[model samples]
Target chain A: MTLSPEELKNFLIELIRTAETRLPVDVYEALKQAYEVEDNPIAKQHLGAILRNSELAAKLGKPICQDTGTPVFYAEMGADFPLRSEFYDIAREAVREATKLVPLRPNAVDPFKKKNTGDNTGRFVPWFEVEIVPGSDLKVTFVAKGGGSEAPSTLRMGLPIRGVRNVWETVLQAIVEAGPKPCPPVIVGVGVAALSDQAMALAKRAALLRPIGDRHPDPEIARLEEEMLKAVNELGIGVHGFGGKVTALDLHIEYAHRHPATYAVAVATNCWAMRRATGYITSEGKWEIISKHITG
Target chain B: MTNVYHLRTPLSEKDVRKLRVGDTVYLSGLIFTARDAAHRKILDLINHGEKLPFDPRGLAVYHVGPVVRRKNGEWEVIAAGPTTSARLEPVEHEFIAKTGVRMIIGKGGMGAKTAEACKKYGAVYAVFTGGAAVLAAQAIKRVVDVYWLDELGIPEAVWLFEVEEFGPLTVTIDATGKNLYDEILERAKRKAQEILSRLS
Candidate 1:
């Protein structure tokens, strides 16, 4: 019962479309909370506009943002899955098709050649990061990482002796420098301990994967997230950098064990759109697409 | 005092200079889109002593890269949202003065030079809601024309759009040289210091 390429392509298109047009449940809820709690009139207006934009995009089944962003997929495959060899090509085909059907903005550009692939497909694009799980099914999540938010993400390397405080300061500096450019109230994801690229990727995953207000299981990490959120909101950068009390809707932290002498901190932020969707498929091509906002 | 104004494009000094920080503006009429690549091309054209593809005076230039789809043989805007303006900060002052565009639409703030250019050249910078691409597209009445679609590609092409009430744009940098983003940065820096110090 191997999944056919046509079936996989169709599922991927649906996944991309859902990710583009709708906000996830946690993101939507946090925005509503921010709108409710915002004290500044200007910030309130910006939040209202964001809510309105979300509403209209949902209604029209159109893209929530103009910059549909870079489509990033994280896949978990059962070790026993039969279609592993064909999955990559099928996914690429889906991205090209989705560019036309879902009308995702063609964002891939050749750095040296200055060429636009036009269909949102290019070398190493619709980027995939895969893991093998024990289950006998495939699970994939799509996150449309918009450029404005990604622009302000940063990584700071510190001496291990500087510890968590330095990481905190770096996060604060990143947010302060980012100001209102990444769009607020932004979700801040902090990755500590891992080196460079892995740290950055972990930071992005923390930003994109974790649900708003979902505290980490570890008490220290949870406390840091809470403090980070409070500190960011106090900066008064507000929505659209206009100044407000709800600058950051949520802050998440993920960490990995690192070398004793070096500490690397990565900070990644996501815009309020927070576009993502999840899908599950089996060898027999039984597809289940579940998006929190769409369903709830 | 912040006032909401209905600004029709092909703006004037009087029209733009009077705008202040935090004023809400609804822009109707014609506007053009240009990103970094298109800006480079337009500036190159000017440097080469060639005529611009379109008139820039009194018109608003949006720093955007839109997603457009072909519908019924016509270009339909799927989502047209503002991109970060800081990427164009180096060239913006020159671009604004040379082109004589009265309004610059983008998100995130530009630099002091751009603010100075706004003051010196009778131009203003406004921020459209970032990530509101689909909502912004609703205001675009039609795609009037496009330039450099092939040479520059879709996102980099200069797209001329006929828009009606195309914004909930907040004037962040005004003709008098005041900038909301800069003011916020100062406050944010002070506030950040306070937070960092207390945390330490």
Candidate 2:
């Protein structure tokens, strides 16, 4: 039985609900660790509050944050998927339905016209990114990107001769200068690529996609991640920048083979409330929520 | 040592003067939410010498754009956590002076300008937990009124709320002008340098 468009929309709605109300287990565990390691009273109290807040949101079926965030969907689909053509419309309708059902804040607004869409859907909103893979199933990931965290995002373009050093400095300055704005205990995603937007997109994916402790597959990249995480923690900006032992819950670095002449580094930061989840649908119409959530 | 103070709205200089940076505060009474747009409007009203929509003197201004809905002709608050406070740094000093709100509640501490205003105006800047919307919503008892709903929309509009024990707010900037985050961040910059030197 092939999954109907209605079924796909339902799955997407569930995906948005999960992203809104629940904290992924990995993210929760990382926060718990941050709370445990912090000697600062303010950081500890704030982390404690965040943990309680997460539990409350889950229990009450309420969004974890007021800033419900921009709806971002990343799809990895099989080339032969039957529902590929209607996927975009299905996703958009799902967001509109989820906005009313989940009671999401209407976040989409026209920059020039200064008018809210009343629904979260608007031109190019609920940003969809797709990559065709070599499978017969469809998988979708939803990330709720908050405005406060996005406020501190950075892009630094520099020459490639001092590429590694520049990337390091850029990340450091981004976090240090970010101060408390991005919300501490942040996930720092760093991307280095030939082009600016590509670097930013990669950085956002790294910040929003990977679990907190997940390291890159490449040893060199993994080592860079580890070093950045260590250095970030030393910055003294603990949970909500209260100044404590844990600054960033995790630091992620993703890079593409860059142009020899130009090196572009982008930083995307997510708050402790990293709201994301994945759903997979088989061609046979079977579907399941894949992301583990913080239950207790 | 951490001191916990429970404060109520329509506060005074004495009420705020007792506060110090890092002290925990649980605020009660009315708190009206505002962000960049609302701040600008409030400042504009003050500059124009116009009668405000509501009496703001001795109240608290929350830095938030909450998610709310209406059911059965009553407002229902869903998620209402603090927004970034630093964004209002440019006009906050004048806001405090003109409005006389004793407590400014938000997250991510404000800058020197806000801190100076807090010192000068007998006000305190406190941080409600960032992104703890559901938890924050639980403390808010009722939506008292609303302003600029049509013009600024929900998030940017002035949402007057009646909150009860609405915090685990950390007083980051106090009436006496001491700012906790300023000191904390200053120390952290030294560590950033150390990490960079070690990296080199």
Candidate 3:
């Protein structure tokens, strides 16, 4: 049976609602682990409250955090997938519906007009990044980025010889400077690319898309993730900047082959809420919401 | 060292004065919402000596744009969490001096001006965990009133809310003009320098 457009729109709506109202399994587990391991009274109490707040949010089916987030989707579709052409329109409709149905806070503002669009959609809203790959199914990942966390986004350019140190400086500085603002115990995403915009996008995806504990496939990159995570936690920015052992839940790095002339680095973070969902529709029309997290 | 305080609105200087950085405070009473737009609007009204739609004296103001819905002709708060507080640092001291608001509740850290204002005006700057919207909504017992919804939009509107047990808020800037974030972040910056030195 062919997958209907209505079905796809409705599925995206579910995905958006799931992302906004519920914490994913991986993120929830990481937070639970953080809470269990924390020793400082200030950090412990704050983490406990975060856990409690998340529980209440899921129980009430409310958006995990008020900034329900700017809607961004990453789609990997098979060349043979039937809905490739319709994905954009379908997502726009879905986001518009979800903005009201999930009751997302209107986040899209016309920069020049300085007015909120009322709906979450504006010129390029519910942004989608698509990849046509070899497969028979379509997988879409939705990330809802909050404004508070987005405020700390950083981008810098330096000589290629300085790439390694630049990466280190940019990521660490962003996190430290953010202190308790981007919401502590954040997930830091660092992107290195030839171009500034590409670096920024990659950094955002790394910070917001990757699972909390999942390491990059490249062992070298994975080691970098582990190293940064350690150094970040050691900074003692703590939960809500109260000063503790855990400042960031995890650190991730994503990079593209850079030009010989330049090294552009970008850094971003996601608040502890980790609002995102991944779903796929098989050629046979079977759908699954694969993002992990379950309430205990 | 951490202490816990439960304070009701129309707070006296003594109420917040007793609060120190790292102390937790729970507020029960009226607090208003104001982001960049609303704060500027309030400042403009204050400068012109025009009456504010709602009184701010002795109460708290939140830096947030909550997710709300209208049901049965009433506003329902779906999620309400603190936004970054640093954005308001430039004008917050003036806001404090003019309004006499005893509490400034938000996340992130405010600058020296806010700290001095807290000291001068007998108020404190507290942090409500960022992204804990549902918890904030639970504390909101009712949407008491709203202003400038048309001009500033939902996110920027001045929303007066009646709340109870509304905290777990940690004082980052105390009435003594001490700032927890500055200390914590400064130490972290130094430690980071140490680590970065070793790593390189």
Candidate 4:
């Protein structure tokens, strides 16, 4: 049976609102760790305040940070999904209502004019990527990516010989150079593959992975994550780059087939506040909360 | 009593040398706001030998693109945080020399050339607190006068604000080659390496 438009719209709005209000569990863990290791009194104090703010926001159902961020939606719809025809439009409407109900900060600005739309919806807003698989359920992931971390996100073109070592060095340089601007301690998502753009996209996708500290299915990638995390923290760009032992809470890498001569690496840094919400819609048009970390 | 100093409208080399790095000074004076585009315009004007809207000598320039508010038919500043100053590094020296400005107020630190020019010209670079836009607005008592650069837009225009006791910024880049930001970064880097080694 086809899902009612109103029900789908409400789910989308709820997802966006929750994404804006809550800092993901992994991001919260990273920030707490950063606060623990921060040496600079001022930076440490700032991190504490941010942590408290996040807690208060979650408790009171308020936006975690002032920069509500641009809404990003990722959908995996089953081939048998009944709402497939109207999914995209429902997502857009949800974002529009979310802009008002959530009171999300007006982040979408006209590139050339630099004028804010004030509703967080503009060209290509609620950016969505849809995948169709054989199933009767629909999976929707909503992420509100902030500008602070996005500003320092990097894509590098590495020589074939450089391989993972080059990826490590480049990420180290990015974190070192980023200092406190990207709002550390940060969770770094690394995308490795043949194309820079696709790799960058995959890096963002990796950000949504569950925060299973020190656990990786791939031993090599897992080892690389551990090594990179240690190296990055050692940079002493501690909490907010204020000089600390814990600069990164964790590192997640997503890999793809690459061209023999090209090693495309993309690093997307997620701030202490990684706002994300995910849910699944079953074939019967019933919503199932797969993973909800809003109260944290 | 509030510390008030009737400094000249535009500060000069001699004026700048008299001030220290951490001194809080009330500039009841005329100052201009210019970031990327306005700096370009100022440079072009200098190149073309055209007259500037305001005199540059001994003047203080704030690096800000304020979110303007309107109330009762008058425009006012709501939040006027300092933008990252390094973006204007390429044009700072030229703007300083040609305009003969004495002081630069911004957030974060500026480049070496700008610091050098400030030292040579007897100027100073001050840093207002980053993310403290609301507090900064309270110091701006009035608009006094405004020259709206209608074309270049809010951030890149030359905004002339009449401020009263408008500062609590530290001297990150002083007149005598003492750069506090550089020192902080270096110390942080060393400490970072030490922390990393311990972890490894």
| Chain B TM-score, one value per candidate, order as shown | 0.98, 0.98, 0.98, 0.88
TM, every model: 0.98, 0.98, 0.97, 0.70
At residue B122, give the lDDT of candidate 4.
71
lDDT of 4 by residue, A1-296 (tens): 66788877887787777777766665676667667766665456446656766765677566665456678888899999888888887887787777666555556778898766656678998688889999988899888887667788888999889667657656776776666666666778888999989889988877555463745689988897887777777666655444556667788888899999899988888776677888888777788556556474
Off by over 4 Å in 4: A59-61, A112-118, A208-214, A283-285, A288-296, B1-85, B88-110, B113-200
lDDT per residue (tens digit) for residues A194-284 in model 2 = 9999999999999999888899999999999998898888788888988888878888889888988889999999998898999998777
Candidates 1 and 3, the one with greater lDDT: 3
DockQ by candidate, in order: 0.80, 0.80, 0.83, 0.12
Ranking by lDDT: 2, 3, 1, 4
lDDT of 4 at A112: 98
Q: Candidate 1 or 4, higher DockQ?
A: 1
> How many Å off is the CA of A92 in candidate 1?
0.9
> CA lDDT of A204 in candidate 2?
96
Candidate 2 chain B worst ten-residue window by lDDT: B191-200
For each candidate, the alpha-carbon lDDT, in order, equals 0.88, 0.90, 0.89, 0.70
Q: Candidate 4 has which clashing residue pairs, if any?
A: A234-B196, A236-B192, B10-B58, B10-B59, B11-B58, B11-B59, B12-B58
The residue ranges of model 2 lying beyond 4 angstroms of the native Cα positions read: none
Q: Model 2: how many Å of interface RMSD?
A: 1.1
